[model samples]
Target: MQLLALQPQRLSAVVRAPASVRLVTPASGMSTYRFNKHVISHHFCANCGCAPFGFGVGPKGEETAAVNVRCLENVDLNAWPRIPYDGRSV
Candidate 1:
């Protein structure tokens, strides 16, 4: 999964959701898993076993979604600046 860090406000502005945003699950069904004392909820496609995104609480205790940018359409990934993160350390 390609991770692009986007602020919640920016994401909401881009998506234009005034209230809340909902993610559409795959037709076959979606399975969820949580690690590290259930801090983050990882969502996966049950049929293909591919992860689409994750739901977690932000640093400020706000709900956040970590979307896999690879799932986005009609976008040039190369154009975006890449910020490397050491997930293992976290």
Candidate 2:
């Protein structure tokens, strides 16, 4: 699988609108970390401690998801495009 080596502070996520995402299980058990950015609610697995996604309001004032592609199953990671982003500078 191909993966981008993002900066420590950078996260290469796929942005999706809230209505577009359907969760298979309830998210009530996940742990959240805001990283001081209360705007985005970063969620990680309580058992594995791996952050798979986040919820936030987009610039357009719509609910959004920040999904980690690496955590997805049945996907060809190498087939995805790589976009560079500098999160540290944000």
Candidate 3:
């Protein structure tokens, strides 16, 4: 997977998988890290070491998960619009 700095407002596509979905070899499962005021847990593959998505509470106190569009297969990233975001300063 390609490593890039994530910024605010950057478009990302993700799919919500069933909780029953299990991680296998080559996947090496995932690890969580806290960020953005320590309210969110970022999940990444242990083997590939790629962050596929993140989970956390929203402003309304609801659970949410965000997945990386680049992580999905059969998707053409070049066809998407590259928007600028500045999340680091937040």
Judged by lDDT, which candidate is best?
2
Candidate 3 deviant stretches above 4 angstroms: 1-28, 59-62
Screening candidate 1 with a backbone cut-off below 3 angstroms (N, C-alpha, C), the clashing residue pairs are: none
User: What lDDT is reached at residue 78 by model 2?
Assistant: 58
Per residue, candidate 2 scores C-alpha lDDT tens digits across 34-72 of: 865578888889888888788998767888887777677
TM-score of 2: 0.78
Q: How far is candidate 3 from the true structure (C-alpha RMSD, Å)?
A: 6.0
Candidate lDDT scores, in order, read: 0.56, 0.71, 0.59
Reference-based lDDT, residue 35, model 1:
82
* Rank by lDDT (best first): 2, 3, 1
Positional deviation of residue 31's Cα in model 3 after best superposition, in angstroms: 1.3
Ten contiguous residues minimizing lDDT sum, candidate 2: 1-10
Evaluate residue 36 in candidate 2 and report its C-alpha lDDT on the 0 to 100 scale.
54
Q: Which sequence of candidate numbers ranks them by TM-score, best first?
A: 2, 1, 3
Q: Which sections of candidate 1 miss by over 4 Å? A: 1-22, 26-28
Of the candidates numbered 1 and 3, which has the greater lDDT value?
3
Q: What is the C-alpha local distance difference test score of candidate 1?
A: 0.56
